[model samples]
Target: MPPKVQQKSKEQKMAAAMAGGKGKKKKWSKGKSRDKVDNKVLFSKEQFDRFHAEVPKMKLITVSAVVEKLKLNGGLARRALRDLEAEGKIKPVLISRSQRIYTRNVAEGDDE
Candidate 1:
């Protein structure tokens, strides 16, 4: 007696590919291309100022915390901090392994 043969439909083949059970996705033919999306944007000075003002109040805030508070993206938040540090406006106070702490340079009049 011979063993039975099985046939799979096109939909089944596609399903397997979609589920990653098959190898890598098939590449587009020559002359075909995909568009790349860019998610980074330059942050404005106003946003940086807002971050600076808020820094004195927060004993410590991570990068994600600033992003959520300012309603800005991660890139913008990072750029703002970098610029502030470059201009001697703010200082970085490193916390544990993955945490970054920030504090403002208290001005002469800010105490009173």
Candidate 2:
């Protein structure tokens, strides 16, 4: 006679998946939104201008550049940049799978 295989409950299945079936927790941490910002309260005009002032002469700046210049975490800066882009204050020049390049909108003769 053949031996019968045991079936697992929902809880036990979840435990097994979480243990090693999913390829470890570190890989999933990158996709989590730990420092999300409220879109309703984003600063458009004033804050956008100030943020640009920090890097006026540059042709293009990455999200990480803004983060380092503004002393904000990478995720927070990325969120703020997205909000600014949606507001039409800045435009995305180039977008890669991992990073985005943004250009500030300034007057024709404006320098610095």
- The C-alpha TM-scores of every prediction are 0.46, 0.45
lDDT of 1: 0.68
Minimum summed lDDT over a 10-residue window in model 1 is located at: 103-112
What lDDT does each candidate get?
0.68, 0.68
Q: What's the CA RMSD for each of the models?
A: 11.8, 12.1
What tens digits encode model 2's per-residue C-alpha lDDT throughout 21-73? 57655544456566754332354576567775665445676766776566556
Candidate 2, 52: how far from true, in Å?
Answer: 6.2
Model 2 residue runs over 4 Å out of place are 1-58, 106-112
Instruction: Give me the runs in candidate 1 sitting further than 4 Å from their true place.
Output: 1-49, 95-97, 107-109
In angstroms, give how far residue 20 of model 2 lies from its true place: 45
Tens-digit lDDT string for candidate 1 (20-104): 7579788976996777544336556886577778854565556777776877777677766777667776667784665666666
